[model samples]
Target chain A: MLSKTIKTILTISAVTFFLSACSTTSTPDSATGSSTDGSSGTSGSSATTDGSGKNSVNDGVVAPTATVFYFDFDSSVLRTDSRALLDAHAAALKASPRSVRLEGHADERGTREYNIALGERRAQAVRAYLVSRGVTSPIEVVSYGEESPAVDASNEYAWQQNRRVEIK
Target chain B: MKKVMKFSIQVIVASFLFVSALSHAELTISITKGVDNPIVIGIVPFNYTGGGPLSENVAAIVSDDLERSGQFGPIAPENMLSYPSLPQDVVFRDWRLLGSEYLVIGDISPTASGYQLVYSLFDVVSQKTILFNQPIVVARDGLRDMAHHVSDKVYEAITGIRGAFSTEIIYVEHQKKARNYRLMRADMDGARPKVLVTSKQPLLSPSWSPDGQSVAYVSFESGRPAIYIQNLATGQREKMTNFKGLNSAPSWSPDGKKLALVLSKDGNPEIYTLDIATKRFTRVTKHFGIDTEPRWTADGKGIIFTSNRGGKPQIYSVVLADGYPQRLTFEGDYNARAQLTPDGKSIIMVHRRNKVFHIATQELATGTVRILTTETDLDESPSIAPNGASLIYATKRNGKGILASVSLDAGSKFALPSTSGDVREPSWSPYF
Candidate 1:
């Protein structure tokens, strides 16, 4: 009975000690994560969401955002303005372990299967950019093809709105 | 086996009619456009020898079918001088004077088992019976189908081509709720509809089994795309594939033993064939560019698929012997969702011209691409009729997606007029 009591006391002490060490390490990491993400997110929202999107075109000062990214018709190349946002998202992910899901969509123009593949390529392009920037978060990608459009009309504005990748 | 009684008695009909009685909506067909020279036809009202109720007007349905094809103009009931029930009574001179090049007459008789339909086709100008008395018997519930068969026979006899009237169609319609879809099957004329499957996600690319007993479609019900094959008669379905990535664009082989579909499980969209019985897979495409929408050749020797490897989407065929895909379409910047014509000498695909997508057919021999539709902003999913006489496709009209059909040789156009929401993905079933 005495040995059992001692063993239980030893186990509890060990658990408490390890938990304290873990919290000590996690506090700094979480602080760094929040600081980085807050700054990056602030800059991204300010640059991309602002109506003065034209000013950032030639300066290479803009970055892509996690909210939405647009691609050219039948093309998957990342735009110049998206680079900053991609880097910001990657930096934020590196600071923390939060995962993300990227949903790819396309306009209702081309063959549905082909559009699905196109949407996939667009998502992958964004994913590749983030990974190249050294992000380690678990990012899941899905292509909805032309099935789920952001706008359900047959116009250029609607098509442009439909062709997008939603980072969640 | 219940008998339906027709009530011409005024008092009984007036009494039972309340709040427009329960009704099953049959899709109405509207021939939005007409052909240059339509053959004039006279369809006399059918004589009924049975004492049961005729649920549908057989002769009138035949006339509607002829009129909707845009190849014939049926004489109106008021314009007909006389109504004939059999070929013996059809005076060819009378029809000739009425400017009808063709005359059709039929009678329905009840047998011990069910009903028998006897029909005849007469050539008014030649003053001869083109088709002798043909007999088709069916169950009480099969009267509409039997009438459609009669229409097929009459169409073939007059037009010198096999008719597609006795076929079915499978399509996907977006339900009232967003992202909800229903996969439905109905007659070619949009009669007798049956919903095969419903999903909260998207459903697309439905292909038919060679025997018309089952269908294969792609469903996103699992929050991811997968291929499923469902048996129509048994209501039994099998999840054919659910890989880590996309499993879509299921097309059955001509022999029904295998299915060719697109799967992105291998990191990118590519053409893969799954053997239904053995559960073996064979990869048909290996390319950095997207290769999808694979369809089997008529001879089953190879597959034709859409590929963007050449900077734009085009049709390419890869035979099993060579294992190398050769480009099949070069006439347009976009030609995808290609299906082979019955003869294997032509390919029908949705083509874009002047930024408007249209249904176009390409003769592989001459490499000639002819655009077939001109009305819709985005015409897609071109499925050829089994007889290869016409095709049905999904097209946008007035901000709504609906179905339209067009002839191959003639520029005749018609629509399956619906009164509801979006209807797309019209797949012409193999003849039953």
Candidate 2:
């Protein structure tokens, strides 16, 4: 019963988004860039552009994707692998002077408060790295804890994916 | 079996001594049994002086609190024959004739800067005053608390057991019909609920210190759950744990100097204790599985917690001094929230059997488990009353969380139905 209700709500949300898109103004540059970026594939477009080099926005200006940091269960320590991703996110934030939100999240296995704290730790870990990288973009950390999940499945893999800190 | 036999013999001997006390009003209850019928008592109208229109009527609130426990039935004021402030003035015969086993009479008058209450209890049949208390002043909007003090006096005098009526209860009440949750505290009978903290996310695992002055609970206020301790009287709070991993399931040390909690700050969730004075944390357990719900022994010598290290969530005792952990529950598939009874001989916990959660008491020495909750549903967080005879816990009814209490012996039971919204994580306070 709960699943059915959620499905209905999601369907309505999708319909609303589609209807609003029809009347919304679209920039011609973004429409062309989206198709070009799609053909190049998401993973292949990492040019590692230095601030000095300006890639042609008309060729394929990919929408900046968020960097996510994953932690060990019930732990706040940033893993070794997450360092690289955090560095990349920090570099991007430095290139773009605008502020970014660090969203903290946790898996569904533990208690709520525990997850909340874990989520905050994850966001703080990413923020600390960004600060070290000279990325001064205003960082605002918010923990979704276990309330918001990256995956809906109940399996271990899904839980691991859910327990993450996303730089948005 | 041998312990039961010895307990029965002890109960008989106690009863004999009670009866031999002659004119002395003595109550001898069986150790393993409780009176199915609540004790009937009358709280006569208290004599008041010059009209200032008091802030509250303590006697009425006391009467309602006792009645709600389902342990005492207070007679209506209209049924009383006479009001007496002192023991010598009470007409015991009149109460006995009215089918009242106990009678309470008191007077409220203006004191230094506040009001003073002088109350006494009389055992109807013995014609003797069971208890007499000196006048107490209403310190500061503390009349409701004074009522609980009166409740303790009457309960102790009648049941021969200390009363938890003076204690408070911590629970989570939903706002806007479960859309939001707030941590709250109230008198044990569920009166004067005051919200301590609130958030849109869920909150859980509220634990009270042995002194009953502070509470440690988990809140998702920061978008992630974190453990926080708040002083009930001052409303002052401090965040105890917000480690990167899980920081939850806090149980205060008996001395109130530390809190035994579960934290995955190091790795997977494990048991750890935080020194309140030094703000230092010491990991107590190292395991690959989940270790949560830590509780301290009355002596503070060891800790009990739920862990899946032994393949399932079972109760385990960890020695604080030596750091040696021993499994405590072998009879149940799942057991959590181990609360030591006041006597410290048995533990009351929620045990899962046949896929239903029930409150169960297990003797530490004999490993004999007695199921206390028999209804068909989820019953968790068993917190024993200060008296150790009854306990209050949270359970599901009509798809909404509510608080229900049961006498350990199954003699009497009552439900504290919430008028606000869903209530959960009920932590019974210790006697103040």
Candidate 3:
């Protein structure tokens, strides 16, 4: 029964996505139109030349696609692979000064409150890295502990995926 | 994208069932293990002389309570040779033939405004009345409470220990499919559950006050984690902490005048005590490592918390006067979420051995360790009963979170499975 319900929900979400896409395409000045082509920087630069200047901040800069950074078990130290992506995020945040929220999470192994503290430590680690990178936008950190899991499983792979901080 | 879709589906389903779930929310208790040689007890069906049937089966409730404690085995009513509601009507030979070592008899008589319960507990072998003609009068809706009272009395009379059957418990139930979280209060046996607070965000670390009139917990209802204290009687809530980084793990002191909680506003997660009235925060631990999960000692003279300053998470106690932390657990590499037993001799905590988490108790003085739960790989948040005979904790069964209880001696065990969703973080209330 649960799987069937999930299937129905997936189908409905797909339909809703398609309908919303159609509605967006029908609008004349839909902001999502330029971003959907994956060449937002080029379109934004042309629009800036057209004197709109609203998209000038993002003219030649590509925002980082990676928002989630994984951590080792019970460790807040960032991985070497996450640095390049975080550098891109720092550049983007510096270019456009928008508030950022860092949500930290942990795997379901230790006690919850301890995990909450661990999650906060992970988020703070990321916040410290971003601040050190000269990104000065307002940064907020929240720890979900193990209460919310990206993948609801108990294996090592799931744990690795769940122990992460999302830059939202 | 998939996560967003799942979350939206959860919100829809939760809103759809919100009304029905409120009216009938409860956790069902299932006894998985009992003592090897449980004491045989016979409970006669209480005679009701009221005009109509009573709302609760007093004798049956009492029987279940005793049996669930794992110390007593109640004989089936069909196996009894006679149903006697009075001490004079109990025949020792009949009960002995039925293999009942002790017997309980009770009856309900109608009163002008409510009902009167008269009960007795007898030792079958000695043919002596242990508790004779104990009368309790209650209003119409308090029959279950009255039955629990009878069970408490009988349990105490036989075991030489105070019974916690009449006490209450608070737990958090999370419906992952619906993204709903509810902080619930219920009888110790998982009956009469009522929602104390509900939110779409997560709630954790529910701590009962020393007076049992209010509860302090961490709620993310306002989009960030903060500590809140809610009066159980008035349903009034006060946001106690709105710190910047983290405000979680609120534990009331033994004196109920202050709350020991974790705050990260200063920098790292550190233990701090907040005066209930003055609202002053006194920093207790000054360490760079993560220091959280602060619990008051029985005397309220020190705070026991989990810290990794020594490299791994271990239980530590910090004296209030000197502010020096003493390590408590050395047997395990992982020990967090510690709670002192009522007598303050032993500490119960989530002990991880061989990468599997289980609830274990360690003596504070002798450093002796006893593992209480061995059946499950993940057991956390163990809350001891006021009498310190048993404890309830959250463990996963078949990938679903459920509340389970085990005796301190590891002789008896039972699981309280929620009817709706996953239940965790059970806080056993103090005796009323």
Candidate 4:
């Protein structure tokens, strides 16, 4: 009887941990006015409200923030304006031991696979820059390939806003 | 004045007959709800100038390609009234009388070192030139390739979708005699298949770069399926993303810089992206459940992939930035191996509903869905042509895997029962 009770408790603990790891809260974009910064989240703006409404903000850990790097149309090359942002990310990552993920993106204009590769190149360029800056804490990179949009509007201005790499 | 007026009237009548003939040449492809009707098209022999018998027959190949789509019924050359080489040469009355809805006319002229092909397509009802393509040339043995170029144009202009004819499809032709799997690259019509690399071991997942110059596929030569990218020009190959556990389903990023592949190197089957230039990899999905068959959206902002995370194999999209994933499909119990249309507005995926696997297209914007294929048994791994008008997928016929294509808009569909062996993993190359 005792052993069975202990096994039940252990299984419950493991399940809770697994659930926490995959936990995501989807809040209305209208309610949360905070936009992704491309590196880490600013406290209490949007990432604060958990979708379930129970323990809206993560209790122990801070929400991940991001610093964004923007690009031109049909291009993966880092623009002149993105250099400063990339530099800041490199410095922040250097100061911390936490690993970073650079997400590459593109405006929805070209074919899907081409956009994927372009987004990858954009993230890789950011990763290479960070490595060059001596931040070596496992900078993982992936290309969203125009799947997610930072801005909801579909015009050129919004698309330009969408074509970016967010470091988190 | 009377003689001149008579000649002008004759010329106009001849021109009218020619225009009508051009219109009548088109094969009216009616794809009404996918019962497998191959589009019948006529590729008349092109008139050649200054040629010492051009080595390759460009028109015949185009006709063969259309026929092989199993969705196209190529008009017999013997039935053509006259081989109209140019627009003014066609007799509309004759072709309209013969019941051809679409007609393609092309000619080859000698260039400095090669040859140039100019082609046009006419819709029978419109009686106007519907499609016109710029001239393309090839030197010596390359005229065959120019034929493919013309095929692409005609296929696109008529269908409002890009044509995969100019693109090469790499598939594993399973030969029963030797029990060997041959990795072959064939013209989109399944002709002139040249074995690039073959193995006794099973070869799967042949993928093409956006540039169409290279192919990345999984080869089991090393006991396990390993990803390899082969350049078409020099036949130079580089072994990419071979890790422990499962390494399969290699898909290319649109820019040709990274590969979205399924690897168990980190633990279970999860999606990973490998940079071609840097040889670096980043894990995309962190699911304990199976996450495989990753494909990119046109804009490269996110990837739509197959994951059993929701209890069944369903399509999901993940933003690469922080691995934020959103479920894209919920209608079917099993949906795997999705390919996007050229416009990226819809995803054609294999959906399993009521224990039958069918090819279905879902509008990403409206969430309105319709099944494009209702094949009785398993129909999997659909790849859209570059033009997005039609799709070619693998299905089973006579217990052997064959290729089939269907026009999504026209509802025209056809099957290509392989004369050789079972063909699998058909990936349409990017438009040339």
Candidate 5:
């Protein structure tokens, strides 16, 4: 049984998942906040706070776009919306020589070691997309698997929040 | 169908949660807390002379060791009629009247460079000394080890099976405060947890070699997960495998010449065996679905692994000659991380029934699956004791990770918990 805080966080995450899942190009300005922040939530909340705001494209540098990308269960194939998000990130990397690390993670289900492979594939897929886009900035990938999660709840919404790749 | 039982355990947070020396807050297992059809016994407090602060008591440690095995029920000191340090002082009638089937007595004395442990095990029924004057020498700081060795000898003399008390266990603790993940080793009684490795990222799936000289585990220290074999004594390590995708779940073969591992380097995850000497690799399973958690059968003829080729994850074994796997589990919709017992008679894995994940055993001959745990949200990673009498696994208690044990037959359960923080990924070490 999930605590009240986790249940509420999952409900909010489910709403956010569906919203982001439907959008084509989730602009960073519009997609900046999700109630499931890293500290209370499982994902990279503290990492995003340190990596964002000043570098966001809408800060008059370029077009603001989403950094974190979500995928379907057990599938590392980048989603259509994630492609658009990655394109913007690739553009940001192309404009500057700044390096970005792709942090990968998976839901807390199945065997941990296998989920590690899944997390690696997810982040490597994002790295492949950025590197293939001719972005000169160095890109790195690290898979946390189900270790550092975004949603503490055990439901599907929470799992979806956990199975994501954060571009840092 | 997954039933969720909600239960809470009081989480006592210790200030020194993370420390360099594992003794900072050793795991204290309450062996006398749970009751079963336990053998009633009495262990007299060990006699000591010229003590330079003996770190542990031999007789008390032996009692705790036997009691924790879930096979022995030790009588409290208050219940004992007399305290005896030798077999001459121990009266059979006195122990018989106290309802103790066996008795233990020991003496410890500090020497110039070490301590001497003299222990004895007696049969209360026949009033005969089973083990007498078992002498052990321990250099100054090795009193705990001497006690465990005595525990080992007494246990074997009475039970006929070699005791695993002197053995060690390797487990991982993933937390926020420390290096995020720590690979640790401790005594079977949950004492002296020494951290072997620490990682900034996640570390999982720690497997020990047959000789207990080294440990091979998956670490993300190089940024991504890769298998590394580290010498336990020298602290020297070598990256065994650093493939492109997945290099995890490394299990050493019984002979120690080969290692069966899970890798996704070729498409999806598959079981592969790596020759330790030649640096050769042999693919064991050919499957489209997720195939992982490959463990060597004790005989070394085949490898048993978990695969989802049949639509749901189940146990399968592949004979090394043909490299063809035969399904061994048909009872449940989900069964993963299957580990064969030392005798090769059964398989222990995380079996899900009605959606509740539990540690279960499947008799290979009968194909009969039996659930070992009753109430828990998620219980997984069932590592069988080297003696095959009990199992230690990671389970969630009050929303935190803790290690729990269960007797294979009696189903008695107990938790070996840390003072604070979550602990998981337990891998029992082989006998040294």
Candidate 6:
């Protein structure tokens, strides 16, 4: 009984450490510049001048919070904006040394089995990007095809969101 | 405590209704378009002489079956001049006056075991009895089946083609809110629905074995996709593929000895055949591009699949001996999910024209493409009947998935009744 209690405490502390490490390693986005540095005194303001004479408030060193990456219809080519976020995730995986799961999805179009292949292609693209970043953690990839949608609607916006790969 | 009890009662009642719905779900068909000059046939009500009230109106079912074929327009019983049960009672003059080219009469008599049906078909135009009294015996609960049997016989005698009224269809129904998916099997006319399997995750790509004894489908119940074959009679399931990647689109070979499926274990999706007896897989296609949705050719010597090797998805046929894939379709920017007709003369596929997905058929010898569906922009997963007369496919109606059927000539069209949730991936079974 005492050993089980100690194991539970150890698991809690380990999870806390892992989460903290993930937050610290993620890179902040330039578009949604969430300032992580409170010493800059620009937390409430929309715009602020930085050292490089730019109006962006973020230092561009904070961790990224976006894990879901979107793709075009019937294509698996990753967007340019997703590169920096994936790099942050790669950094987190390098620091924590944990297994990652990449779940791929597709919009509700085309034949179902073909969509399964398309989803896997997206997931494989993400896996390749992470691997190229020198991350050694084992990555498992699975594609749900067009079965599970991020949004239940059947519009263009929903389709864009549904064609994505989520990192868990 | 009282509120909890009330909620429990409601839950029990709701679950009971759900089970009942699964078992008794019947697809009501509405004919959108029919043949221009349908042959009119007059069917007299079958005279039933059983111990108690008959459970099913056998003659009505027969009339419905024949009418749904789009080749025969059954005359209503109320309009019939006489109710005939035998050849002697069928007045050729009366049917000719009613503008019916043919007449059908039947009688159901109670037997020691159950019942015996004696039916006859008469050619009103020729003024001769084409089919003599044909008798079929069935148990008490098989009135519907007995009706379908009579319809099949009459249909073949008239159209010279074996009827598919007695066949069955399998489809997947998904309840999005509950995250539940049920694989259902029903009669060809959508009656007596029975659930084959249910899962919390998604189920798709259901294919029937050639013998109609078992079905193969891809299920994600285990948090990942895997192919499974379930016996229709015993409800026993066997996991056919459990590879690290996709194991989907399991198409039974014509001989039923092997299954052609897609597996991505070797870096990307490719077609492979699994020997059922030996449990060995032989890679059929060796391509870096995505080759998937593999369907066996009618001859079973080659496989026709969807591949994006030429910058876009198109139908391709690869012979097992040569391992060389020859492209078959060239007219469409997107053509996938290729299913050959029973004659193997043409390929039926989901084709895109003007960015609208429709079911189209292409002649292999002439490269002539003919589009079949024009009602909806999202029609897909076309499964042809064994007789090659009609095909059923999934289409979206008001954002809800439903099944629709169209004759090969694109003359007759009908939509299956929409269930509570979405229904997709319809697979018409081979003749039982």
lDDT of 6 by residue, B56-145 (tens): 777777876776687766776666788889888777888877777889899899988778999999988889888899999999788889
DockQ of structure 5 = 0.29
Per-candidate local distance difference test = 0.76, 0.67, 0.81, 0.65, 0.72, 0.79
- Per-candidate TM-score against the hidden true structure: 0.85, 0.67, 0.86, 0.61, 0.80, 0.86
lDDT for position B360 in model 3: 96
What tens-digit string does per-residue lDDT give for candidate 2 at A17-103?
233223222231332221221111222336422221133223343333435666766566665444433444555555556787888
Interface CA RMSD, all predictions: 1.0, 6.3, 0.7, 13.5, 2.4, 0.8
Local error of candidate 1 at B416, Å? 1.7
DockQ comparison, 1 vs 6, better candidate: 6
Task: Give residue B117's lDDT in candidate 2 (0 to 100).
Answer: 86
Q: What is the interface RMSD of candidate 5, in Å?
A: 2.4
Model 5 lDDT tens row, A99-155: 777788887765576566678778877777666656777776667778777766566
Candidates 5 and 6 compared: the better one by TM-score is 6
Q: Of the pair 4 and 6, which is ahead by lDDT?
A: 6
- lDDT winner between candidates 3 and 4: 3
- Which residue pairs clash in candidate 6? A26-A63, A26-A64, A27-A62, A27-A63, A27-A64, A28-A62
- Counted clashes in each candidate structure: 4, 10, 0, 50, 7, 6
The candidate scoring highest on lDDT is: 3
| Model 1: per-residue Cα lDDT over B65-142, one tens digit each | 666676776666556789888776877777776677888888899988788888888888778888778899999788
Candidate 3 residue lDDT tens string, B1-432: 011222222322232233223323378766677666667788888999877787777877787788778777677666679999988898899988766789999989988878899999999989999999999998877888888999999999999999998999999999887889999999998888999988999999999898999999999999999899999999999999999988989999999999999999988899999998999999999999999999998888999999999999999999999999999999888999999998989999999888889999999889998899999878999999999999999999998999999999998898889988999999999999
Candidate 5 runs further than 4 Å off = A1-64, A69-103, A120-142, A152-157, B1-24, B31-33, B51-53
lDDT of prediction 2: 0.67
Q: Pairs clashing in candidate 3? A: none
Chain B TM-score of every predicted model: 0.92, 0.84, 0.93, 0.80, 0.92, 0.93
Q: lDDT of model 2 at residue B425? A: 72
Candidate 4 DockQ category?
A: incorrect
Q: Which has the better TM-score: candidate 1, or candidate 2?
A: 1
Return the clash pairs for model 1, or none: A63-A84, A63-A85, A64-A82, A64-A85
DockQ for model 2 equals 0.06
Q: The CA-based lDDT of model 4 is what?
A: 0.65
**What fraction of the native alpha-carbon contacts across the interface, defined at 8 angstroms, is recovered by model 6?**
0.72
Query: Candidate 3: lDDT of B144?
Result: 80
